[model samples]
Target: MALLLQLFFAHKVTALSILADMYKKRLIEDKEVVIASIVGMFPMGVRVVVLLLAPVAISVLGLKLGIIYVLLEVLSKFMVALIGVFLDRKYLAGGVLEYITNVSLKNSMLDAFKQFFKVLSILVPSIFLAMLLIDLSFNSLVSQISIETAHLLIVVTGTTSTIAGLGVAGSLIATNEVDGKSALLLLMIASALHRIVESLRFSMPVNISLFGSFGVRLTLILLLMNELASIFAILGLFLIINFGFV
Candidate 1:
């Protein structure tokens, strides 16, 4: 179940659906689902990705904004720890040290490995397919963006995809068409606005189909939480830029 949680937890709606289903089935309580909502948004894999992307962001967003980007990911993780892990520790399970007295270490390890890999075989491929489809769709949208518009166009392109926007922003910055600070701000605006559009088209409908009214409710909560975070980030960035504080 820890492995399954690891798999689902990265995709926010997927995580919420699983957790919410658990609640409906009485596997866990409502607070477990709601409080751990941040985990549905950030998850463990995303934290790893954030670290991996830090240097790339530095090169694209430059030193200051890049650091801010990393901090945003950290903020999400911190929320998960405070809200999710604190409320529900069941997924943490037991370690070898903790299980040492209860069972044969060799048998335990062998059985655990077999069970984990058996589930992994099914889930890993499904996850890969989902990721590939999403990437293909986003890449198609990104390919449509024209970086020639520079400043304002960066925002438009960003609404298509952040990766697309970042590439466009980098080009504009290179040509001295837009500054790092303004580029980052526009990116945030595009990202925040895009989130709304995406929810309406994809997540909202899909979730409602699966979980009905509960899905609508959960979807809204997650969207609101994420949007609020983006709002604060934008305001914080604005202040730093305006004050020349980097």
Candidate 2:
């Protein structure tokens, strides 16, 4: 699974390189683009490594500490991004430092505050609408399922299908001690299938065809998740775990 995800990430990086090439003034050098993509893959690698090593870590460190280490490792990428941004500004022309120096701090703060509120304005209502829709749909479709299944349904279909939903669902799972495998599976499926409404909302203003974009994205996500390589990788992890290899 991790290997497949890396391949998908590489594909995205290739697309980004193509897009950069089309611009008259390239933001990043050709070689640097590939380097950046490889560097970016580190987080995915960390995720896989942590999951693979989790059993051993939990046994050695205890579950709470082990989970904390895993979370910190995942979040460490943000530090890497921060350092990358700093380097870009220090070494590259027309980087973020130039823009930062040009803008007034007060204005920047005000703009950030406005944007925060603006996002909240959109998000609060969308969340309520999503909740209402999920309530209606689940009641109609499968009202007799267990509480865990109900939560999974809400997470998959009743929230934004992007990173926002991932955070929300992850928090719920952690708090409720939900089955990790089930939560991961549902989250992946949700990421692929849901968010159509959000995608349409963003794409319409840019004149992109909603159906075309959604179809392509959904197909790619499903394909990557279901690919034989990914399946075998996941199976390998299970086999190792079952054999007490950790």
Candidate 3:
């Protein structure tokens, strides 16, 4: 239940901090707690919402490509999370199973909610600042970008900085630089390459601050999982494109 809530309300650092707290408190006795968190922190639904609202995603990609993008993200995240769950099972101690077996469903739900919100305070400030940054300068940021690697820039720049990629892709589409299917494929690759640099800034410091050396390892694991998911998505995209299903 904790993992389910985390998956739905994913804020990576916040989720990790909460998990780290649970570990410290011994509320969770699993050595693969990190994996458990990863399984639930994919942000699939959140990204779909973002895609729907973001001007860049809508204007450049259009409805079809936008839907494709959402599908890819959802599928990739789901696949990766499922894999993490399976891997976690290998390391799970009997205690968690026993705890689950003994606990009432109502109590389990309540505890999951409590654990999930333990780091809400940490997330709120960051959310506000990020929204502020986007409101103040997102248009300007997107407007100034004129680059060929728009897709790559999108992923590398992280979610907040996608305005730049939006501008670049929008321009490219306007000028007939790439067709919709082609652009979709390019963007697909970029999406798969995502959070590369942004993860360092947002993920590294927060994880390290909360979990110390363990946080470092955790951050690395998170990055690996993201890349792995991206690879899986890109490969799927390739197959789809090659098969004329684009």
Q: What TM-score would every model get versus the actual structure?
A: 0.61, 0.35, 0.66
- lDDT of each residue in 1-246, candidate 2, tens digit only: 233234323333233323234322444453343234334434443643343334333443346534543443344444443444555556555523111112244754565466456545644554455455455664455546645443555365434543334344444444453445444444434533443454355423222222234335433432342232223334544554477544
**Which of the predicted structures, 1 or 2, would earn the higher lDDT when compared with the native?**
1
Q: Which portions of model 3 show Cα errors greater than 4 Å? A: 3-10, 43-56, 94-160
lDDT for each candidate structure:
0.58, 0.41, 0.57
- So what's the TM-score on candidate 1? 0.61
In angstroms, the error of model 1 at 119 is 28
Number of the candidate with higher TM-score, 1 or 3: 3
Which lDDT tens digits does candidate 3 get at residues 1-246? 465344335444445556666777777744466666567655633543453324345655576665676566667777888887777767665454222212245754565466445434323443344345444654456556754343433333334343444444445555564566666566555554446665787778887787677777777887788778778778877877888877
How does model 3 score by TM-score? Answer: 0.66
Clashing pairs in 1: none
- lDDT, candidate 2, residue 36? 40
